[model samples]
Target: MPQPPADAPALAADYFQGYSVVGLLAALGVLFVAVAFGAGRLLRPVAPTPEKLMTYECGVDPVGEGWAHTQVRYYVYAFLYVIFAVDSIFLFPWATVFAAPGYGATTLVEMFVFLGFLTVGLLYAYKKGVLEWT
Candidate 1:
């Protein structure tokens, strides 16, 4: 395929022209949201009272302080699991790409680099004792 001119101005102009419809649609989406919000604010009834102002949870009246202490380990464990899960998901597509004729070497190197990053993250988590279960 023939390449376009590498000049910054020319490249930017071409890029904008190529994506003009996308930009226009994005702008329109933003405008639609703004108009919808503006209309909602103008039309909605505001009759604030004590009952309405109070925090409601699943039709049950909130009791005690809203703030509660949560264990940080639970979140760390969940985040670590999510990272591994997503990385495993990435491997399936890479496996297919690795089997393909022209992409094997490139894909293999890329996969190693990706695995190296995941190894570093896992090592960091292990060092922090996040992997240890109580």
Candidate 2:
């Protein structure tokens, strides 16, 4: 291996200078946020009325319970959507890589394995009647 130049210390300082600049900028950002929050807290009025303290929902008065039961089917649908969305994302990159030389057979097999897993999950969901709308 080639020996580093005699000016290695200078190079190290130059590298650290970049980090120091970044650190300074980060500190400035935090300081700015702190100053803004402090100014807002100091300048804002402290008067608290019943209406102001209560939760406001548009212009309409509050209705029944705030918490409502959400159906598990909605969550299942969302999970399936996310799975397919991620599958599409992976597909695009895999297509590009699959077209590259020498990666054809390997990527093809790997992709089949991936699709197999998805298919198994889909079949499992179907068996569980999760796909039923009723």
Off by over 4 Å in 1: 1-16, 102-120, 123-127
Highest lDDT model number: 2
State the lDDT of candidate 1 residue by residue for 35-125, as single tens digits.
9999999999999999999998999999999999998999998998899899999999999989999999999999999999999999999
- Model 1 lDDT on a 0 to 1 scale: 0.93
Lowest summed lDDT across 10 adjacent residues in model 1 is found at: 2-11
RMSD of 1: 5.6
Error of 2 at 34 (Å): 2.5
For each candidate, what is the lDDT?
A: 0.93, 0.96
lDDT of 2 by residue, 27-100 (tens): 99999999999999999999999988777889877788778898999999999999999999999999999999
TM-score, every prediction: 0.69, 0.75
